[model samples]
Target: MDRAGERSPWPWSTVRRVLATGGVMIAIAGKLLAHDPSATITWNREVSRIVYERCASCHHPGGTSFSLMTYQDAQPRAAAIKASVLSRRMPPWGAVKGFGDFRDDKSLTQEQISLVTAWVEGGAPRGNNPNALPPAPKFGEPRREEIPTSGLAVSGDLTIDRPITVDGLWPEHVPPGASMQIVAAWQNGRVEPLLWLYEYNDSYRHPFRFRRAIEIPAGTTIRGVPRDAKIVLMTADDNSWFSRLRALFRKTG
Candidate 1:
């Protein structure tokens, strides 16, 4: 130890001893942490909020999915809930972990997902305060539907003199026989997949909305190919029909 309380470089001969000490400390700390464990997770205080905000939108009546609004509704499905949320099949946001920052991101962090998993494995307790639970989530009403896109469009691919950005596309219309394919995303000259194929499935047919706007640098390029496809780009808030005829026949304000 020096006067500044910093250690000078250890002699090479003592390096092995120092490393061995660190290893032992790390192992002991790991065991201590394991013994302590995380706090017990429960539904009424924790898990319900996660589900109501993410799952109940689709899991409620008149909304095309089963209800998960109440403890009773969800208790029976605890295992499946844990499985789906952990696998990211629920909430349905498809951003690859650590890939991009997004607004309105439905996907939970790993810790949040783990809490749900632990709650289930720990017997899905309702906790001791059911009456104090937050009001049931009201996501099933008529409103803008949730969109599950592959991920945010990224643009660090370009070597630009200035920053660039792209306001996201909210696809409002698709002409029949039209299909769109996102082949790949480019970043710093490296190719990555942000691919999606337009299909007959309802989920695929629905328009995609980025959870937030995307910024495209001046030199970046996102290459996509369309085949016999007619997709009309519109804002997320646009409620207008795609057909020219529909616009023509609509009553004026």
Candidate 2:
């Protein structure tokens, strides 16, 4: 999930713009290392290693967007790279940081980000140890799929039907042959489908943090639905999405 902090709105609409192996140990040098006033930060020693650990998964050939697998590919995209990371727009995990310890959270740390900034700002050097780069990340699971599912309107509202924002949903387990989507009913009485999760995997599951967090005002009616399963909404710990999730589980469990 992307961490919440003050950030100028990313102009990704303006057109701009990895996986870590080795058990998260050195997948990256992590701290961005104590800055060496004279140490050279080159592609081999630092930059490409960072790229492989955090970016290569989706950026590789035949993956999703264009490739960032090589320095050649990443060099030209330096500006866009800096924009996405600094804006916290890429590595799209929707949960806000400092709230939950999400597995595979690809959001870059401040130091890591600083490293990137330095690299891009200083000409993105390709230094020694190109071959020292670790194996790039790869995910065997399907990144996406379309599945038949019911919309939130499909299930009648049980509460007072007043406006309320959707933050999280849970089943504890979505067994084999089980999958679902968590749809959001907007505050304006309009229904817009939010998350459509298929082949439901908990490790990959994340709460939907609204870009513009919707607050359901009293008297505004809305609804939710459960498709082939029990679906519950979380409405606590406004500051921490998953913290609210844990509390929800405690109450129901």
Candidate 3:
């Protein structure tokens, strides 16, 4: 060895170890810096406009059932919101991929879904920028008033037999499979209207069981309806004629 001389070329193994350690450190740092784009956008601009435009019609205060107005209003229920959005459940309007044109569609855009997911993950921080507040949504121009329509009869009472979430399918995304069945008895108290609600977000003709009407109630035409007086029958997820005609009417409008 030379006097006061230092050493040899670095071995391959040592070089690899050093490189691996550096790579890991770099990865950790990148993760720290890798914030969700939605959060950044929202902090810059009140991105809740996506909600107002795409969702708040039904999911706003004094609306149907839920609200997506503000971060504070949404943060507590962030996880559920995430699940619903990712699954495309909250935007209850159902238009399957490649389906016909829908006039009043409310499915989320890819960017919107990403924004909501990112916001939820980023602690749902409502940025201090005073401008970060979208204008109050106006669900305008109500549809023309139609004649009083009779709701579908629930031949029998049925519950949400299977408990899981569903998704909404779009041009860029396909929802996961979710199957639920509703068992019902006909108004005649004999036939049953078995409704199978699948969440595949695809198109396929499926068969349902409902025997033709035999008799009508006094002063009442035979119609499928919920046995429970409290249950309010409404349209299914999608606005298909099949969904409208073969109704799985329930209070879970």
Candidate 4:
């Protein structure tokens, strides 16, 4: 047996540091923020609400790597957010927008972009809603139909009931220091090898394993790891289809 043990890839400890603690997440968010006042819109409760409706489905917690659920999540990446939206990176979402009609679209309008910009410049204030916004959407089990049977499928005879969506065909912005962990295993004698990597909306990051593969047995209990855990684990690259798509359209648009 492979010992059925757990290991952390990174040389760090497990601690839930706040976002402002000057960690990798904060560092990246700070670098991506912009200083231009003219391009920003004054965001109040209303504006933030709109952003939540249009953007946060995927940007929010558990849907993907980062959570745009709170002001903290969006504030740090304000500049990057503007860049992606202005360039239609946040919403247009296809290798070329207007090429295909998608069920879920996260692209914002010019007005929406302006609104987000102003919100950031206005200090990204959070207006009062006695009840905080609902929790970010949660990911469910991978669905058999959702996985591409043409290219790859889960190993063995096993299948996922909930969908592990893979949005793609274009590029979009992902929050800095966002993290994700996928727990999967080989099935049916590992015929397909059960390769899993990150992709941006552009469907890039193919064969996305930057490091070596994290091999597992046919059935694995430790399918994934968390960012704050002892392991650094794995992350999808900038061009990953899932990363970009999730950032823009909420789901694999």
Q: For model 3, state the Cα shift of residue 119 in Å.
A: 1.2
Residue 52 CA displacement from its true place in model 2, Å: 1.8
Candidate 1 structure, TM-score to reference: 0.53
- Please give the lDDT score for candidate 1: 0.56
1 against 3, candidate with superior TM-score: 1
Per-residue lDDT over 1-253 for candidate 3, one digit per residue giving the tens place of the 0 to 100 score: 2356855478778889999999999999788766545235452354577767776666667776677676667667878977987877767644342232234446677778888788777766667776757677666553442321332323334322222111111111223453433333333455322233346344311112122222222222212223332212322233442334343333332
Arranged by lDDT with the best first, the candidates are 1, 2, 3, 4
* Lowest lDDT 10-residue stretch of candidate 2: 146-155
Most lDDT-accurate candidate: 1
Give the poorly placed runs of model 4, Cα more than 4 Å off. 1-44, 95-101, 128-201, 204-253
> What is the per-residue lDDT of model 1 for residues 71-174, given as tens digits with 9 covering 90 to 100?
88888999998898876766665444444333566668787798889999999888896775878866535677545232222212212222333333333333
RMSD for each model, in Å, please? 11.2, 19.3, 14.7, 22.8
lDDT of 4 by residue, 1-101 (tens): 12566554533433334433658876776666643345344334445566667766556565544776667677778787777776665643322233323
Number of the predicted model whose TM-score against the real structure is largest: 1
What candidate 3 gets wrong by more than 4 Å, as runs, is 1-46, 139-253
Overall local distance difference test of candidate 4: 0.42
Model 2 CA deviation exceeding 4 Å by range = 1-38, 137-142, 145-253
| Candidate 1 deviant stretches above 4 angstroms | 1-37, 144-165, 169-212, 215-219, 223-253
> The CA-based lDDT of model 3 is what?
0.48
List the candidate numbers ranked by TM-score, top first.
1, 2, 3, 4
Q: How far is candidate 1 from the true structure (C-alpha RMSD, Å)?
A: 11.2
On TM-score, the stronger of 2 and 4 is: 2
